[model samples]
Target: MKPLSSTLAPGNGGAAGQTGLETNNAGRDMKIIATGLLVLMAIVYFTSKSYEEVHPALGFVRAFAEAAMVGGLADWFAVTALFRHPMGIPIPHTAIIPRNKDRIGNTLANFLKSNFLITRIVAQRMHGVDLAGGVGRFLKSPSGGEGRLKMGASRLIGDIIASLDQDRLGSMFKGAVKSQARDLDLATPLGQILEVVMKENRHGPLIDSTIKWAYRTLDANEYVIRAIVFDRANTVMRWTGLDDRLANEVVDGLYKLLADMASDPEHPVRTKSEEALAQLAVELKTDPALRERIEQWKLEMIENPAIADWIDGIWENGRNALLKASRDPDAAMAGHFGDALMQLGSSLQKDPILNRQLNRFARRAVAGVVASYGDNIVKLVSETIHGWDAQTITDRVENAVGRDLQYIRVNGTLVGGLVGVSLHTLGYWI
Candidate 1:
């Protein structure tokens, strides 16, 4: 009895005992049919030997036919056993696909990563071509780029305006204030600002008006002054028994004295206030306790609901300002920003050196980011490659060209047989 594999060999000229599957594949089908026909032919020749003694030439034909059947069946079995169990008997080491589908997928992934997605291939693709340039081109191009830029600007402004929630605004303000408190020495900035205010004479007019109001307040309250003076005169009259008219005269004089003191800008009280403020500044600067207290007081204020309310108001104001700017592009806020932007653009346009520096910085900044993340790209490929299924790799390749490869086997059989016969005839003639 022949082993089942020999007859199933798809292209080889083997024996007649090949399995039925060779007929299923297009290339192997004809070989299988021919194998069967050859077996029949051999059987016929031998059977004819009974009728008439057959020549040895017929025996050679019988040998060739038998061999072809064996080759066809063996090849057929070998191919079929790869994808399924032989005859569906579920034999061990057969039907590898269904048993290990995940492994197949993994192997396929690995093969792709190794062969198609290697680092050199990736690096070669990455070299010399300005990815940054492409993005810049896309953004800065004249063809609809200006429109896109405007749209992007509008969207950005809109999103910023919309995303300005109270919590976010509060957080931002809190951050700004906290940084100023911690990082900025308020005394210096405040002093400088106050100096500027003083230098500009902005505070002088206000202070002068306040002093003039104090003088007016005294004039308005002259009766209170007169009452004090009259009351003192009454006491003096009781002491000296002076004339009533003379006492009244003394009281009137005292009234005038009180009014003068109140009216004077160089009054002792006003001078003392200025001195006290100066002393307070010294304490704020030199006194650690005072500084600590200031910080504590600031922290308390920041935590206060008033601060939160102020943040809300600020956010609302900012939002309203932005909304106004967005709605009316020619509004004051928008106009100011536009003017500032135009100035900046004009400066960049004028300053060649500065423009080149900016361009270089922008390019380097992008390159830096890519260099930082490049390793991750490499790792992704390697890790993927290291985890795929071998069989899956094989199967995918086969599917891509499996039908084509079947022709190779068919052509090989025909071509090999033709060469064999030609050589055999050449030798016979020689």
Candidate 2:
């Protein structure tokens, strides 16, 4: 049975087959016409010779007919010899295409490799191609490359999502996160962050808030302060009535001092708080003992089983969410992927620098490949031609150019007749 493509093709004979058939038919038709003219000339020559005694004009007719037959026969031989020996007689230089098919093939291959497939020619042609512009137009078109890309990406994502082992991914993710955390030294970065905060005076607000909380606590617990003051008084003074009054006076004085400290921004206590923070920041950064302690604490946390469990839990939760989303057709992940592809296409179109780089790379890649494989291509062409039989080569060449060659036979017969007539007239006039 014939292939579907062959069956569905426009004509039973394809382009090359159709062209070969047409040429063969035309060549046969011209051969018949040329042969018929030759036969007609022969008949006329014989008839003129037979009638030459009856009329003097018959001599010129005989000359023209004889010359025309000679010309037609000569042209027919010349044309036939191109494909085969004329009349089956063995002749040199006959059937030239079949005789030198291998050499012809080699020459043709070399010519193509040198002229058409050279690195410079390939590069120049590649550079001239508007690859970026074509891509841009395809992506920009609604039903063109953009839609195809989206469909392809969707299928790929679906396949990948379906193929993933959730358990394996979860384990890998957990292991990777824990490994990274354990490998990282947290102390240096933390200290640097603290140093930056202190330098920018960001810790000032924190100190103020701490001070306000302390003041609130102290004010609310005045009775406790009073009892402590009374206990600290002399035993004899406590026994007298003046002890209570003296304790009140001391408590009031302490309250006044607290108020003054809190109200004044430049108070000694505020200055001391700022100084303490600065000192702490410096120690965290510069003090090796502090830094080592912080590192040790971080390592302890990382090494804890609880911390490992926590990391695993995070991975499990994330995996579950991802798997669920992947199963959903309307998931944002697929949409986001599509958007990203479109954006990339747009960038390739709009960004001249990127487009130029892409085109330059493409040209270089094509040129490099052509340079590397050109010899192989030439060899392939030569080998293909060499593989064909002599008969096949003869048929192919004759079919391709035979129709045009038939015209020479027709011209020769007519021209020879005219020349013969002119010569006969000149001879008679002389």
lDDT of each: 0.54, 0.77
lDDT leader: 2
| Candidate 2 per-residue C-alpha lDDT over 1-430 given as tens digits, one digit per residue, 9 for 90 to 100 | 3443443333355454676577788878877888888899999999999999999889999989988988888888888887788878888877777778999999999999989999988887897887876666654453553654555444445556546677788778877887888778676677677778878978767776876777787779878877886878888888885678876887787667667767787888778878887777778778899888987888888879998889888877766665555344334334666566567678888999988888888888888878899899999999989999999878777767776777888788888988888899899799
Task: Tell me the RMSD of model 2 versus the true structure.
Answer: 14.8
Segments in model 1 whose C-alpha atoms lie over 4 Å from true places: 1-145, 156-185, 195-210, 216-281, 289-300, 319-336, 351-430
At residue 53, candidate 1 shows an lDDT of 43
lDDT of 2 at 393: 79
Query: Best candidate, TM-score-wise?
Result: 2
Model 2 TM-score, 2 decimals: 0.46
Worst 10 residues of 1 by lDDT: 14-23
